[model samples]
Target: MTTQAADAAGSDKLDSGVLKVAGVVVLGAIMSILDITVVSVALPTFQRDFNATYATVAWTMTAYTLALATVIPITGWAADRFGTKRLYLLSLTLFVGGSVLCSVAWDIGPLIVFRALQGLGGGMLMPLGMTIMTRAAGPDRVGRVMAVLGVPMLLGPIGGPILGGWLIEAAGWHWIFLINLPIGVIAFVLSLRILPKDKPQPSESFDFLGMLLLSPGLALFLYGVSSVPGEGTVAAGKVLIPALIGLALLVSFVLHALRKEHALIDLGLFKNRNLTISTTTLSLFTVAFMGAMLLLPSYFLQVRGETTLHAGLLIAPQGLGAMLTMPMAGRLTDRIGPGKLVLPGIVLIALGMSAFTQVTADSSYVLLLGALFVSGLGMGMTMMPIMSAALASLTHQQVARGSTMMNIIQQTAGSIGTAVMSVILTNQVLNSPEATAYSAVTQGQVPASQVAPAVLDQGQSSLADAFGHTYTIAVVLLALCLIPAFFLPRKRIEKAPDATDEALPVAVGMH
Candidate 1:
């Protein structure tokens, strides 16, 4: 073979190797994300199966989310102290083990505990997967790598419900947890073979005080936010007290971090313009998108009278649109930068959100599908590029901390969105004239389904109006996100190569 041909072949081999590493990370991430969303569709079934009250069953989700928030703050430190590969393997094991335990759980209490155990491992996977991929792909190709990695983010929410609904119908709820085993095993084995081995940074000091302050603080804050949906108001004592205590602890941690040189997560990274703007925009985008997503399934199930499987399938168009647009967006982001893409993406999202505000009880299915598709396209163009821009602004040493910070913000913002939207929807439904009349007739016992036909009709109309109002609030939130989107950097940044050698270590065995 000619020398140039041989060079081309070698380059192809190197590219292929990078893809294998990214694929493994993406697979593990999908399992982690899918677990949270898939289980959501089974919540009602859990109450039935365990013969438990709504509040007790609800703790299944609450425990998982709280554990996730508590553990996420410590991931960067853990990754640095232990090697990233070892940490990744250990996390995957814990998550899979938790899944196994959950499948065989005999009671609600054990189920909640096992779910929290799952969260312990699941929380670390996202940030660490991103960190691993960013390091392997290097700065020059980070955008494309992120695009590939973003597939799971796009698919998880849309696919989870569909998969969960099917499992419940065909194999029972146990299969939801059981499904993780093969996927986890495959990812674990591939990672052991292909992932580069890094030496642990033993010289790094553990940040005990920071962990104490930040972990519980974040967990409490998330707990407060999660309470809003159940309490139906921010003014409720359950909401206010935990939120205030969390705020105080977070404030103390911020002050401590500002003073210390070796904090758990470096707050100083916010000084980078690109990083700051990208993080802010990403958080806002998540709030808007997640709020709308929360409304979609409930709307279908309650208003349209769709089964969980059908409702989940209805949500798939958005994922389809995102899948179509993301690869192109990733390429454009690498060439022209994130701001150019984000502005148009935000506009499309606004247009899609606006369409939902017009929804009625008998609105066109085609129109809803189209709007969801457009919104997904917008997400594809916006989210990954914004994340890429943030990582591009940081030095290699900061990537781990930066990933952790981004995930925390994203999770927190999503919680806030869910809470705010749920409260708004609940209030609107209760205040509607039809609901007020129907409530008086039924005395808040069982739903109007057992009452007269007219009562059922009135309740349905009230719910439609309530959902419409909730969507309008979502549109407004999406519009507000435009302010941050405009501030994103318009040109690709050239980040310093401080830790690239350590990041992309020599591939040892695979040919």
Candidate 2:
């Protein structure tokens, strides 16, 4: 044990034991992250199988996201209250059980309910995983470990649609949920055997008041935001009423949190300037980047008449580009500071996305792919470094709470970005003279080539214009991210003196 501790303390490289724990965390993360995108591609399949409208089927996604938002505010407290190892196992159990139930759901309503149940578990996985890894890696190596954990974040979007599309086409929609059974079981078992036993501090009182306010507030606000794309206007009653109520509750929570030491999310963490700037930067980057990412597959399917699988394949270059830069950026972040890497990354992203603002119906595939690859390269440098900068400066005790806050900001920002962009594109398409033909192409009701040539030409042009205009907004948002990135710490972060090196047991019996 002394030898193991000495080895861990002496080395900067990740030893085998830490890598094993990372593997466990990554597996759980894959299951949680992949579920979101996997289910998205299966939505149309749900509509067909359950004989439901698109709006009704969309609740499957909305319900899952709402459950995620609702459960997230409580996770930091829960991890400390319940041992992380035990809670992690329970989450895996719930998620897998929900997956099983979803596979057998008989109606759209049942599926939506089951998906929310799944999300209740999924919401905790990433943040919990972050806490575990942060502890295991210690503050000095957080940048590298965070980069390792970022694998699924990059892979899920690229792989989910392809996997989901293939499953839906070859087997059935049920397999999409059923797929989690094997992965979940393996993750559960590995977690039990590999992870360090939890050291829970249950002394802090649970913040029930904060929970009541923030959880419902986030769910309601996001619910209203999610409604915008479908309703086509934020002024609609359904959008306005719930959003206003949610805003009121959120404001109340903020005021209430300010007075309390142990609020649900610990709003006081914003006192850390690094965390504040990083949070702002993450919010803007996710809104612009993720929102734009969602639109790419849609573009290929609608304008280019590609299969879901093909669209997913086409988007792979961006992920591949990210893959190229993530590891190098991680190492550099540990040696330097995030601000240096992040500024250049944002610039590259803006440059890559600039091409999309000029997209035409027959834009060169090579050119588009090159642009996406460049954007991916920028992503590799940007996302996790910001995360590392935020958490590295926090005390070991505060890592869980800090990660929770970051996750909440990310979820809310991403939802808003998706909703806002969708509305813009939807409006642009609807207002076009070729609205009917373009709508048919987008909805998969008709192929662009099959339409009258003149109409196809004009309609495709109109559709491209809408997408181009939307990309312009996304680029502007990316530029806004640069303002915050410029402020991130540029020097190597020092470890907090209190961050003791408690090396994890290499195996179940070794300690």
Candidate 3:
């Protein structure tokens, strides 16, 4: 063959390899994301089944979130110490085992405990998957590959509730956890066959002190934030005490990281302009987006008087819009850069949130659905591109650490958003002029059916106003995210070969 023909053949082999790696990794990613959202929809069912109080049963989610936060700081070191492929498989095994236990759980306490084990596995899957894919794709193709990997993130939230509701109504709640078994098994088997072997970095040492400080710190902080929704105020002891301790420990870890040559995660990565800006943008956008997501369901179920399954279906359009735009956004990010796409995306998200601010109790379904669709489109355009740009900014050696830090920030931001929005919505509801009147109607002095029309109208309007205020806050937060997007690089930087890539087989062992 001529020289040109040889180059074309090699290029085809490279493209094929990228797709295979992305496919296997995405299966694991989908399982983790699906499990999180799916379990959420079943919380009420669990409460009834286990005969547990709301406070106790709530730990099913709280434990998982805290465990996930605690384990994330250590993933970078673990990935480097063990091989990435090996660690990825181990995470899947732990997750699958936890799911099995959860399926058979006899009570709330056992289920919560098992969910934490599941979180440990789920936590590592995301950052490790990203690190593996980033290294495999090389920086040049990071944009397109990250976009492909992002499909699970986009689809999971949209599909999880719909699927969970169907399973619970048609099959049973056990099916929610049991369903993960087959997917996890298939992903594990495929990964072992398809993933390239990564040689462990023996020179890397574990930072025991850093781990002790950071892990608990993250857990406590997330726990404190999680308490806000239940407690109704950050001033409550449950929220205040843990948050302060968590802050102190986190500060100490930062100081320790700065001093150590090889810390758990290199805080020094902040020096990279592209990475710092991208991280900030991602965190702010997540805060705004997550808060709105929490509020939307309550609006549908409580104010609009929709059923659980119906509310889940209502949210589908947003995810659909995001799914539609992501591939195009990914290509654009690679061709130009994140800057152009992310700016417009943020603006579009803000516009969508803005629409919610004007919503009334009787707003049209078509109007709300259109707004959600636009917001989803904006999310698709923004999230993966920023992720792609952040990973692209790091050298191959820095991919593991960079991926971990990004996940940590995103998780914290989500917790903060949830907590903040919960507080705001609760306060609005309590302080509304209709609160006392609504309380009287619910006190059983009169049947809801016989309550005066005026009283019913006031209650619905109050709830709608409370939700609208929460959405207004979300819009403002999303608009603020644009500031960081300005600082992202206009084009992706070409990556140089690193020592870590030396042990990998050609085309990452593609057949």
Candidate 4:
């Protein structure tokens, strides 16, 4: 909608300007989520194009994700120091530039380097955008604004793989990154026009020491988490050394923050009762969501013996499920409360996962689709309410720190979740590939000479059973997550009767 039309609809509802800003803000979320989702389907192309091992090629995604995670802590200060719009524009420029560089990267080394640059840029987008959009929305209307922004955050991951898979087949893997260029350009331009025109705050320092402590700590942590045992993409230095250094730096930063009169993140926020409990839940919830989401596709392709395209198609339903359900859940969070929405969402996700717990070598396609939809439905409902409740207790000033902290923990939880599940799946599948391999090998009965190199390289299982066992392991992880969902509270937040609805537009992003 045009800015004028948007203003007309909700004069005091939202800044007429924010409808436009929402597009600009959620671009970061879209970019970050899509990077991982879009590329999973293109691993085969990466293998052929860059001549990479399975472990190394996976880093293209892992490196970006870790780099993104590592840099997330810095965004609040970055925005406070640099001015959100300027930094945001710079981030978009970097992401677009990195995408172009990645498209032309001739070697795997260059590609990985280029992807890291992309991650560095992308790592800031979601949190910063969230800080901006959320601050703009203010507490009174956070529910409404989040409901709007949630569209892209939820859809991007669910859709990224499908969009990337289709585009890769139709255009090429290069198009995946290339596609971001137009989106970035539009967002950058709109940000200049629509984002809150705010001044940088006083006494800004770059916090070089904070960077020193945090980045490597996060990178190391991610490296350890991504390492999948025998399938082994674990970086020894990347996983261990940086992790040690990063941890030391982080610890030192905490000490520094404690000693200093002013620090980037006030360690004092942790003292808040509501903030503490809610943040913990956010972290755990993310671990459950991201860990399981990552496994779904691998289960389909590696264990189920489906082609990449078919696997992607089935996975799309999960996204679809999330897309349809989140809006209602967000509203429900406003109406009932976070507890009701979050707990049921978790339960539904667990139930959907439970459905998969029954998945076997002979499970029907119908059963798989139904379970994915249910799982997606559960997750869709969960994300917004949990986020809303976590931030709800914090004032606007507290939110800037609290939100970033929440993002850090939630993002970290996902990484850890995936790591935990991968360890389990990899070990179990590697050990049990025999039966599944036997079935596919006997059936394809294709001679080695006839099999494609890519097909042959996957190993052991005659493809079919390998995939079946993979799904089996994923279901186990799903079951592990179910244990936690059972304990979440059932209270829902109803809209406060005394809360004023007819005020001037809630001042979002000003915080």
Estimate the TM-score for candidate 4. Answer: 0.84
Q: Estimate each model's TM-score.
A: 0.94, 0.97, 0.94, 0.84
In angstroms, give how far residue 344 of model 3 lies from its true place. 0.1
Clashing pairs in 3: none
Q: Residue-wise lDDT of candidate 2 within 202-283, one digit each (tens)?
A: 5489889999999999999999999998899999989999999999999999999999988888888899888999999999
On a 0 to 100 scale, what is the lDDT of residue 227 in model 4? Answer: 64
Give candidate 3's TM-score: 0.94
Which one is best on lDDT? Answer: 2
| Model 4 Cα lDDT, one tens digit per residue, 9-74 | 344355655566676787766776777778777777898888767678888888788878777888
Candidate 2 C-alpha error for residue 281, in Å: 0.6
* Prediction-by-prediction clash tally: 0, 0, 0, 23
**TM-score, prediction 1:** 0.94
Winner by TM-score: 2
Q: If the candidates were sorted by their TM-score against the true structure, best first, what order would they fall in?
A: 2, 1, 3, 4
Report the C-alpha lDDT of model 3 over 361-427, residue by residue, as the tens digit.
Answer: 8999999999999998898899999998888767777889999999999999998998899889888
